[model samples]
Target: MEKLYNKYEVYNRWLQDSDGYWQEFIEKTAGYIYWAKKPEKIFEWNPPNPFKWFVGGYTNAGYSAVDYKLGRFGDKTAYIYINPEASVERRITYGELYQLVCRISAALRAFGVKKGDTILVYMPNSIEAVAVLLAAARIGAVSSTVFAGFSPKAVADRIELVEPKIIFTQDYSLRRGRRIALKENIDEALKLSTWRPQAVVVKRALGEEKEPPMERGRDMWLEEFLEMGKHGNCTPEFVESNEPLFVLPTSGTTAKPKPVVHVHGGYQVWIVHGALLVYGLSSDDVIFNTSDIGWIVGQSYIVFAPTIMGTTSILFDGAIDYPKPDLFWEIIEKYKPTLIWTSPTAARMLMRLGVSHARRHDLSSVKRVVTAGEVLNPEVWRWLYEEAFQKNVPVIDHWWQTELGGPAIGYYYALVKDMPVGLEFMEIKPGSAGVPLPGVEVEVVDERGNAVSAGQKGTLVLKRPFPGMTPTLWKDHKRYMAEYWERYEGKLVYYTGDAAYIDDEGYVWFGGRADEVIKIAGHRIGTIEVESALLTHPAVAEAAVVGVPDPIRGEAIAAFVVLKPSWRPTEELRKELIEHVRKTFGPIAVFAGLEFVNMLPKTRSGKIMRRVLKRLWTGEPIGDISTIEDEASVEEIREAISRLKVVKVSE
Candidate 1:
C-alpha cells in the first residue's frame, strides 16, 4: 500500500503548530456536512474546564441524518433490520424513516415533550428503538437510552438523573429464543423512581409474554401514539450547535454509573467526518455494526454516522451464535456489507467455534473488519485475519471510550485525497491502534504531566479538545472536571483514564485501564499483556488477569481463563499456560495462579469487567453487575477459584 500522508510530518505539526493544523483540518472536513449556520469560530477553550466547538452555529442532528439525504437518496435503503428469530427482515428507506421520525416527534410533543426536555428509551434493537432516538433528536429533546439488559435498579438510577418527561419501551424482548419482559422491568423501575413519566409501549413479542397492565392515564400503545401525531403539525427543531443531544451512562468500578453528555453541532461534525475518514463509507456501502443501540458504538455507527453519510446500516436483534456459530457470516452473505465492526469479545467467542463455521459461508463482500470496546489481543486478531477473513481484508483495531464519543486513534482510509478503493488503501499495524485521527491530539504522559518516550507506559491524554468530545457530565459539571480535567490542572489536557504507550512508528499500544494495572514488587504490568500472552497458547480461549493481595509480594497476578472446547481443565494445562506467559514476557509476568473457567464477566458492549474479578477474588463487595451479559459467569469464576491451588512464591 502507498502512503497517503507522511505520518511523521502530521505528528510533528500537531505537536509544534496545533492551531494551524487544526484550523486547516476543520475547514476541510467541515465541508462534508451540511450546516444550517456556519460557525464564526471553529473552537474555543476556557481555562481549567469549559470547552466549546463550532461556536455560533445552528443545526439539528436528526435533520442532517434523515432529512438531508431524502432529496438525493429518498428511495435508498437507510436501515436493514433482522428480527430476533432471523425469520423476517425489513428494509427502510430515507423517506420512510423521515416520516416515522416526524410522526414520533409530533406524538412526543402531544404528550408534553418539548425542547430541552429529556426522553428515556428502554427497548431492544428494533426499528421502534431507532425511531424513538431520532424522534427525540428531531424535537431537540435529550434522549437517554438504557440498555434493555439492565435491571430495574440500574434503570431507575438513570431515570432519576434525567427525570425524563416521556419514556418509550417495548412489551418484551427476545434473546437466544428466550422472552424477556421489558415492560415489567420498566414498571418496576417506575415504582422505584419518584417521577412519573408518560410511557409508550411497543408490542415487540406479541405472544411470548402476557402484556403488563398499563396505567390508565400514564401509558399508551405505540400505534395509538403515532395516531396522536397525525392530527398535529411537527417540524424539526434547529437549536444551537452545543445543545445537549443525548446522555449515555458509562459504568465504572464505583456503584453509581456516570452519565456522559454529547451535543449536536460538534458531535454531528465528528460523526460525519469519522464515517468518511475512518470507516470510508460511501452511498453504495452497507455497514453491519454488531452492537446494541444502547451503547455508544451503536449510537454512533449504527444510527448517526451511516445515516448522515446516506449509507445503509444493519441491525441484528439476536446473538452472534444464537442459531449457529456462523449466523454473523450468514448476515454478511445476505447483506453483502462492505464494512463490519464489532467488539473483540464477539471475535473471541467466534474463535471458540473454530474456523469451519465461517468457512461454510462466503464473505467476499466484506472489504474491512474492525474491533473496539476492548483490547484486540494478538491471538484473536491473527485468527480473525488468517482464518475468518483468509488474509483478504484489513483487520483494523481502533481505540476510543464512551466519554470520547468516537474513535480517536485508528487507520484512516480517507485521510488523504485520491486513495484506492480496497483494503490496500489503509495500513494495518498488528497489536496497535493506528495513529491519531486528523485534528485529534493524543499523547502518552507520566504522572507529572510530561510526555513519555517510546516503549514507556503512561496515562493517555488528549492535549486539546475535539469536536466530538463531551462538554460535561449530565448536571454534574463539577464531577466531570474533577474526573477528567483535575489531573491535568496546570495543563489543558483531558485525561482518558487509559494506560498506553506510543511505539516508535507513532502507533498507540493500549496497556489497559489505569486502575487495572497490576503492580508486583516494584514492576508495573498491564493485565492485557499477561492476558494476551495466555491467549497465545492453543488451549486458552479467553483470559482475564487481576491483581490480588499477597503476603510476600505487594500484589500477585491471578489469571482466569476460558479454554477452547477441545481442552479440559487440568493441572498440566494450567502449568503449561503459566510457562507460556513466563517464557513470552520473562519471569516478571508469571502468574501466581491460573483458573480455567467457562466465561469472563463482561459488559453488554463486550468489555471484560476486570474490576468485578478483582472484587470477587479479594472478597470485596461487587458493586454493580447490571450491565453484565451473563451473571452466571461470575458464579462460575467463584467456584473455579475455590478448586484451584495457589502457587506459592518465596519472599
Candidate 2:
C-alpha cells in the first residue's frame, strides 16, 4: 500500500518536464477563463474552486483549438491521412487546416447555417467530417454527429431531437473494398421526417449521380456548396464558456437515447490542458486514435487534444481487424504513431489475436498505449505491457466517462515512472483507479452524505464541478439535477452513478454502477435499455436483463427471455435477435446470445427476478424461489444449459 512512486511529481514537473507542462496549463486557463462573464444565477460553479474551470470565459473554440495552434505551430502537421484504401496518404499542416476551416465556415453560412443553429453530421472519418466539425465550432453553431454505422431509425431519432438546420453526409464511402451507400441511409432516415434539413452531401464515390432528386432546396452536392464560396472570413464567433458546443447522444436506460451536452470553453480547455499532463501527448508525437469522432474518446483525443497540441492524428474509415488482423500494427508501422489511444475492450480483443498479430509488423514507434471505456483488468494490462509493448512502453488505464469529459482518475507516467514491473498504476491498490488529477476533488460517500472510510464501497461522487463536466443534458435541466445534484441537495457534488471504494493507498476501485447498467466490452448499456431492445424483437414475449461476469470486459449482458408461442430458440433465431439488437442500438446492444426460457421468474407485482438470474449465471446458490410465479422456470433454464453444455462457447 506504500506509495509506488513520488505522487507529488504529478502536480510539479519532476518528470518529463521538457515543455513546462503545468506552467503552460496555468497560463492557458488564465488567458481563456476570463474572456466572458456569466450571469450570477446561471453561474452556479465559479473559478477559484477546482471544479469551476472557466467560469466567465468568452472565447471562440476555433481560436483556442485551431488558431492558437496556427499562431504557434504554423507548419506543424495538423492531420495525417491514410486513405480509405490504405494505398494513399497525405498530411495537412496546421496552416492548411485553419484555411479549410475558414472556407468551410463560409460554406456552411452560405448554406443557411447560423450561430445557435444545429448541424447534423452523419459521415465517415474523412477530412470533411473533421473540417465540418471545426467549421461548426468556428461559427458558434452546435453540431451533433451520429456514428456512421447507425441504422436509419436510430439516425432519424437523433435528427428529430435537434431538428438541425443542415445535415452533412457523403454520397458513398469505401470500407475495405466494399462501397457502403452512405447517402442511401441518409435519404431513408429523412425521407418521411416531419422536419427536413438541407443536406450537404459529399460525393465520396464520384461519377454516379445515382441518388434520386434532392427535393429541390433541401439537398445539394458538396462540390456545388464549396463552389458557392471560394473563401471564408476566418472569424471566430466568441461564445460564452457555459454555452453548449455540441450534443452527444448516448444510449439511455430507456429505448430512446439521451443527448449529453458538452459546453464550449470549459470542455475544450479541459482536454487542451489535461492531455498535456495525463497522456503526456506532445506536439512532436504522432497519434493514431482508433475511435471515431462520434464518441467522447475520439472527440477528446483525436480531434480536440491533438489539434490543441498541433500534432498529427491518423483517422481510419474501416474495421481495425479488416483486410488483416494486424492492420493496427501496420498503421503504426506505416505512420510511426508515437501514441496509441484506444479502448480496453479493443486491447482485450487484440490480445486474443495474440502477440503474433502485433509482431507481424514493426511497432518500434509506439511509446505509449492508453485504454479507456472500461477498467483495465490486471491480466489484460500485463498482457498489453509485457506481450505487446514488450514491457518497455507503459499501457495507461484511463478512468473517465462520457459525462466527465476527460480523465478524472488515470495512471500517468509522470508519477509512475520508476515503479516496478506490473506496478504501472502508481497510486494505491492493484485494481484501483488512480488518484484524481492535480486539482479535482473526488470521494466515495455513503447515503448520509458522509465520506465512507477507506475500503468501504459507496457512491462515487465529484465534490466539485471540473472544467470538463457537462453543464446539463440537452433540454433536461431537472433530470440533470436529479441525477447528479439531488443526492447531496445542498452540496456541490455530482453523483457519478458508479459505485467504488478508495483503498488506504488512495486509489479508487470501481464496484460497478449502483443502478442496473451493464457494461459490455466497456460500453455502458442500461439493463433496462437491453430489456427494451429484447422486447422489440418479434419473438420475444418477456425479457429480463442482467450483467454476467467476464474476464476481459467488466461485464457482459445476459438476458432470460421468454418467447411467443411456437417461436423456439434456434441458432437462426439467436442470430436474428443478435442482429436485431445491433441494428436497433448499434454494436454495444448485442452483448450476448439470447437465452430462451419457457417462463421467466417474477414477483407477484410483475417485477422480474433479475437477482435470481444473476445468481444462476454466476453459479451461486439460489436463495428463495417461493416468490417466483413459476418456480420451474429456473429448473428449465438449468436443464437447457445442461443439454447445450456451452460453458466456454465463444459466440
Top lDDT model: 1
Clashes of each: 0, 4
lDDT of 2 by residue, 1-651 (tens): 225235455433313441244334535444322243432222244422223334555666666667777666778887877663645567888888888888888887876678889998899787778888888987889999887877776788889887899899987766767676777788888964677888888876545546644657778888787866676454678887767788888765556667888887668767754575567766778888888877778777876767766678887766677778888788888889888988777787788888898877788998888777767777788888888888778777767888878888876554222221112335323355677665456788886778888899898888766668787777776666665564465666777877888787667788666567777766666777678867888899888877777665667777667899968778778778767767665655644435777887788788777767777777888777778887877787666545433632234
Q: What is the lDDT of candidate 2?
A: 0.71
Flag clash pairs in model 2.
35-58, 36-56, 36-58, 51-465
Can you write out model 1's per-residue Cα lDDT over 1-651, one digit (the tens) per residue? 013335434445555565565456556654345567777776787755568887888888888888888888889888899974747688889999988888998988887789999999988787778988988888899999987876676688789988899889988877777777888888999998998898989986554457778999988899998998787757888888899999997654333567889999888877765666677777778898888888888888887878877888887887887876688888888789999998776887788888988898889999889888666778778999999999998888888877778888887655435221123355677788787876677788887888889889899899777888998989988888877774454676788877899877678898656666564532345577677768878888899988776432336788899989999988788778887766543344545588878899999999998878887877879887999999999998877666644543221
Off by over 4 Å in 1: 1-5, 8-32, 84-86, 415-426, 487-489, 516-651
